[model samples]
Target: MPQAQKGICAEPNLHALYLMFNVHEDHDEEVRRILAQILNIFDHYDDEHYEAMVSGVIAIGSNYWMELYPGFLPAELAPFPDMHCEDRHAPVVPCDLFIQMRADRADICHAMGTAVYDALKPHVELVEQIKGFRFLDGRDLTGFVDGTENPKGMHKLDVAIIGDEDPEFAGGSYIHIQRYRHNLSKWNQLDVPHQEEIFGRTKTDDIEFASEMKKPFAHTKRTNLKDANGNSIEILRQSMPYGDMKEQGLFFVSCAKSPQPFTKMLESMIFGDAHGNYDKLMDYTTAETGAAFFAPSVDFLKFQGMS
Candidate 1:
């Protein structure tokens, strides 16, 4: 098995910092070296604070992959699947690099961000940053538990890591992210029962409704898709709710062995089925940005970068 990056399947942390950047022209080699050895930056802090469980991920955006490595591409690598359905939107916001740092301590996550920025200074321009935290007992700001369907234990690796089918990219994972700005004021107007109906789950207990009880447009109904063979298309979800006094929403991130799962899930949510019943939750949240990236295996980053 290839050495997968530690952060890709890392357990949820108390704090996370996501940074997106655009690598400057003529700095490809320098950026490559920095990203290749980024683990050392993470290890430097993790060694002293193992209790913090600090982990990091360095990913190259779909658009920048060819620029960085002109030799070849990950077989399934593709740009963001920007989609629209009536009023629903999944907008594309491409970036050359995406780095995620997570740890139990917000301070450590911040420190990692500082170090990462320092290493890439002048070679990259920071475009966006979203700091996220565990919300109210691992529930979303919407007062519902999140990531309830995440694959557990070794199953996460099975679902999130690429296999021999794409040997060159084995152990790498396809990543898709969207910044959703939720209109909590509007969502809160609904009663618990109404909310539960939209989510297709019991809010307090976080239990999925029976298949027969699930509504066609409920989020779970739309996202819990199946492939042609009647198998569920799964992705390891790494979403968290982020909020400030003025803004609140989800930082939706997911990883899978291939990009198809992410694309298909989004389509199901936006386009719905032949009946045209889309995910009802889209009405309360706006997907502000979307990006696609590939987090290559650790060994690939280490050996391929300087090759």
Candidate 2:
């Protein structure tokens, strides 16, 4: 039997929960209080993490906030999707909150419901009422399966950088989040080979297409970074498969040395360049949300600038 070819890369535990909210400038203090109260409740009741294992940092200068999961959650509360066939596990069965100041109440409700899968856990009962929302599932739009192949072990080191990415950020990395919607009905219509072509790899992430047949024009090819000596630059991809059947998709998050790589990747995705033909997967998905945020090191939270 042929020895199995070693896979080149992997993914780490990637659990994500985000929201954009509305808060008047005058109410910043109150909003911070509400957020802090919620965080406290979760920190106390949440069996998975404590302050040490997790990093709860305030972003947007009390206007925005986020919490990082130090590890995975219990089996009862894990993120699941239909497409994954691997005997796998869930990562960071944690939650987060965001404020939507630009939109009205209805829009905020829809965004949370659609982006966070509130129905699956019943926001009122689990969060507001129970003080926390039990973890649930985040699936991409196509509904076949998602997040089955993630980087683990040294791969985490490869993709998630340390102090090198940002001087002030010694332990943390830059985080980027994008919400994408999938046209599953449309995607389902395409043949499997075509799907594979769009992804630039096998469904299992096991193989790339034959070099000649490979679509050299793709974000994968373009942003597949190389060092000064021409080695692949590594970045951690902790993106989670998110969305429901109707308004579902991915909560794409990546941490890297600099935003340039990701920006260049997106540019290639939007306007196909030489090697990046753009992600053919776009045929079935739409980019609906985009934002860039800095995830500073724990020590750098209080510091401003150069971080």
Candidate 3:
């Protein structure tokens, strides 16, 4: 098996930096050089305390993948599609490249982010950057624990890393990212029971509702998708809460063997079930940015020469 990125299955970090960039129209060659340089730095970084992962967009208009991998691309790779419902919209804003850095300390994450920005200075323009931190016991700003249903142990590897299904891209993972801004004032106005009904779980105890008791439009129910055979589809969530007094919400990060699970979940959230009710969580939060990228194996990056 090819070596996967260290951060995919690593323990959750206390601090993270999410960076997205678009290459200059005529500077594709220069951007490639910068990728190799940044990868070299990641190669020597201490994974015990910090982790870095990189990815490039694979759509037709983006030359990053064509110039590097040529004919090989993740089977499900595509530009993120916009989502709309009766009252809300999730817009698609694709970027050419993405870099994520995580560490236990804020200073370490900052230093790594600065190094990456310096390397790509001349070739790329920043699209979005977010600093995320783990909230109390990994809860979101809404006062409920996040990622309670994520796969654990070896199951995480099974759910996240590409295997025999796509042998050529084995060990790679498809990633989806979005930034959500919360309406804390509106959310805070609701009682605890009302909030729990929206999430389908008890806020204080983190206990999920029984299947029969779950509402059709509850967040947990809407997002939990199953395959045709009735087996549950899973995705590794590395999301974290971000904000200040002015802005606060989640920087959603999801990794999977393929993009199907993430795409399906998003559709369900934005459009709702056959009954036509969407996720109530959206009523309290607004999606500001959405994009998709493919994070390749470490071995692939080391050998694919951009110079």
**Index of the highest-TM-score prediction:** 1
lDDT (Cα, tens digit) per residue for candidate 3, span 42-152: 554554343433222111122256644677777777767678887778877778888887777787778778988998888778888899999999899999999999999
Regarding TM-score, does 2 or 3 come out ahead?
3
RMSD of each: 0.8, 13.4, 2.9
Candidate 1's TM-score: 0.98
Cα RMSD of predicted structure 3: 2.9
- lDDT at 134 for candidate 2? 13
Q: Looking at candidate 2, what is the lDDT of residue 268?
A: 50
The pairs that clash in candidate 3 are none
Tens-place lDDT per residue, model 2, 1-307, is 1111011122222232344333333443344334434333323422343222222322231113322222311111112111111221112222233321111122332333343333222322222111111123323444333433334676664454444433434454445555666677788898877776676556544365555666765334544645579766555554545554356566665555455556555555555655435556665676555555444343342222222
Best candidate, lDDT-wise? 1
Minimum summed lDDT over a 10-residue window in model 3 is located at 54-63
List candidate 3 segments past 4 Å from native: 47-64
lDDT score for residue 76 of model 3? 74
lDDT by residue for model 1 over 1-307, one digit each (tens)?
Answer: 8888888999999999999999999999888888877778898889989999999888899999998877869999999998988999999999999999999999999999999999998799999999999997799888889998889999999999999989988989999989999999999999999999999999999999998999999999999988999998999988878889999999999999999999998999999999998999999999999999999998888886687
Winner on lDDT between 1 and 3 is: 1
Better of 2 and 3 by lDDT: 3
Rank order (by lDDT, best first): 1, 3, 2
